[model samples]
Target: MNPKLRRRAAGHGGTFSRQDAVESGYTVSQVRERLRDGRWILLRRGFYAERSDSTDRPPWERETEAHRLAVHAAARALAGSAVVISHQSAVVLHGLPSWGLDLDLVHVTRTDRGHGRILAGTSHHVGELPASAVTSAEGLPATTVARAIIETSCAARYEAAVVLCDSGLRSGLVTRTDLTEMLGQMSGWPGTGTPLAAVAFADERSESVGETRLRVLLDTHGLPAPDLQVPFGTGPNEVVARVDFFFREYQVVVEFDGMLKYRDDAVGAVVREKHREDRLRSAGVLVVRVTWDDLDQPERVVHRIRQAFARAERAGMRRVHP
Candidate 1:
């Protein structure tokens, strides 16, 4: 194996372009051969990704893989192309809720004639991006954190925008100047104004769609909000367990279990979660578990929550979704 190819293959997650492999000693023919033999998965015309057990992942995982491919292909979209994933696509990639489509197939591009976009599920826009607003995802350069914020944000995106700006910038993924500029540049788009509620949830720290959906439902049902990441003790505010939703006044916690909870190493996280649930249960707290399928029948979610609320009422414990 070419040292370059070998090194590129070493990473758990990354992408490759023809130029990289060419520099590594493999001709385009060899790259094509490697792909045909299942050693690689062609992400785009000149880009390749290794095929492994990771390729056997769920469809959504594959969708993300395809998205990475699209981002990789952006460099080849046209001569001097500067395409980057943006809009709902970046929001999903950023793992934030833009408009709550359980699954989304949208990305944005910076180019002329940005229109009824197709292929790669892309959307186009006319704009100039500061070099700083573009960052690479898994070796595929993408719109910068600020540009992504502008692309992904709508009225509903204020909270996500806040987090993307605050956390992303603070973490060194982006800069305040770019974020502010992007926000300003996109001021005229419909629903560009941020929402106060979204701003409030900026630091919510939700880790999954299930959690976000659960929080939305709770908020919609008018429940008093739960403290998202709580500290078990005061010394340094370490989180022994961070719950999906918890009503501290009633000693109740709820979590959602998607299929990910049943897989290999993930099952261990489930087991640990169950052990924590047991501890909370033994301590007289109520623990509730919900799953994606449960989300399909929201009444079920409402019923369980209502039952729990009734129990809390019986115990004279108060703190509802209001």
Candidate 2:
């Protein structure tokens, strides 16, 4: 690779345009050869990402990094300065939690008047993007966290919207008050109600996307609301465990087991979690576990939890007052 091209690629988060490669003393053939030899990755037409050997990161994290790179490349390719990254694109840049979002398109908002358009995997949203609604992420112009969450929530499904809103609030990227204010500003707009509902349902205590999705699922199934991040076995100065979901009335605890928890030290984490459950069980607490696969079958998960609740009720398990 040309030295100048290498430096340019390094500066642009390991992604660069064909024009950049050519201007840095590389020919079109060279670029094609590098791509064919696994030295670079073709992100989209005219955009390329330098290949790296690191494979230790999770798939989601790697995909998010790629999305960030594509957003930057798209911003550089745009003709004018009116575009600011928005929606799920901005969410990736801001390091906010997201799931089931389209990663192929570079999403941007145009401050000028016009309809949003898609071209070459780039999505442009043209509307009133005031200065206050804009911010910088990774040195690229993008929407503020609160604005991004609102924009995403309006366009996303109920589960995805709740996850984004919950993540934004939990990460302190946006405050509850700021989200409410943003909703007020976007009042009467089409699809505003979805975002409003998502914000209302969002809780900052949701520590992961899975937890947020579970909360939505439980609500959708008409199950009673479970206290989030609830503590069990509390005394004057003692606390045995902090559970994911606690149903005091039913003496049941629901845990959304994300892969990250056991990704490292899987055996040890499982052993520790088993012991914790044993202690809870000894105290007459019914513990139920939900995994990613369980999330896919919402009905089954609901049924299992309901069964657990019924069993706890039949056993007359005494609730531990925290």
**Candidate achieving the largest TM-score:** 2
Taking the tens digit of each residue's C-alpha lDDT, what string does model 2 give over 50-72?
87655977777778888887887
lDDT of each: 0.60, 0.85
At residue 237, candidate 1 shows an lDDT of 46
Clash pairs detected, candidate 1: 133-144, 134-144, 222-321, 222-322, 223-320, 223-321, 223-322, 224-320, 224-321, 224-322
What value of lDDT does candidate 1 attain over all alpha carbons?
A: 0.60
Per-residue alpha-carbon lDDT of model 1 for 1-322, expressed as tens digits?
5667768644423566678788889888887798889887766566677665664576666665556555444445443654666664565456433333222344556644355455544455556666666666544456665566655556344434454444554355555555556667766767666622343454436556566666666766677687674434223544355566777876667777777766778758878877887765655557788887787777778789778877977987765456
Q: After superposition, how far is residue 193 of candidate 2 from its true place, in Å?
A: 1.6
TM-score of each: 0.68, 0.91
What is the Cα-based lDDT of residue 226 in candidate 1? 74
Question: What is the Cα-based lDDT of residue 241 in candidate 1?
Answer: 57
